[model samples]
Target: MRSFFRGVFVIFFLMTASNWASASIGCGDFLRDIASPPDTIEFVGCESEPTKQGAPLTALYRVKGKDALAAELYLDKKMGVTERMKFVCCVWEVRGETFYKDKKTGLGYHIRMGSEETIHNKREEWSKIGYFYITVVHLREPL
Candidate 1:
């Protein structure tokens, strides 16, 4: 019993540590790759718009570089958006890079509000979405 419990604890610790390390390391890599040479990026702030659910949606971010090398992100609750009762999504644009690269890591974060059933009740229901989402962009040269 003792050995079994010890083994379980070790596995759990390793898993948790691994997850944390991965998240931070991934973000670091993302920042290094996307951030510009001088690292003089700008935070463009939030932009409000209507969501598919018909609720008010806002996106916030830090951007860098120009069109081809530029980076843009959306602000979301998981990164600390208040409200806590709406869905949130993010979009990114970078010079020479497709939107898919934005999906790589640490580019966006999301949150879902309310129960699955409640949120699914309507296509435009804001309850299924996050209250907000956060976006981040890095402008860096080739390594």
Candidate 2:
């Protein structure tokens, strides 16, 4: 009986471990290292809010930085991770745009290389990197 119980325990452990390993981590983990330069990202937090039909809407990170940078990440239900990233490039309406695509490495990035816009104009960009939905917004700092 002891040996049989030990066998069952081992099987349970393996099953649980495998499932945990296969599970995709939340978006916050993907954004942990990301930073919008001049302001360092110190914390990456995640939460799920109640939505319609009892379904939870996950806001991977709703940042409220203290003397730092704050931002939000939003997902488009109609777009896959890669498709959403492609859309980001088209929406970037900077005066001078530099876009880079790397099919071999599956990495894409762009830089808004143009004249600065007026402070009142909202500057926002969205993209996906890996499993992360990234949003970069330039806004007037709140007093």
lDDT of 1 by residue, 6-114 (tens): 2222322222211221232222323234433223333335333223221112223332212112112221211232332222122111112112123355333222112
- Expressed as tens digits, the lDDT of each residue in 35-143 for candidate 2 is 2222232233434323322112122222222211122221111111222112222221222222223333322222221111122222332212111122221111111
Best by lDDT: 1
Candidate achieving the largest TM-score: 2
Residue pairs that clash (backbone atoms under 3 angstroms), model 2: none
Please, what is the TM-score per model?
0.18, 0.21
RMSD of 2: 19.6
| lDDT (C-alpha, whole model) for all candidates | 0.25, 0.23
Residue 8 of model 1 has an lDDT of 20
- Deviation in Å, model 1, residue 102 alpha carbon: 5.1
Q: Show model 2 residue runs off by greater than 4 Å.
A: 1-22, 26-29, 33-39, 42-44, 49-119, 122-143
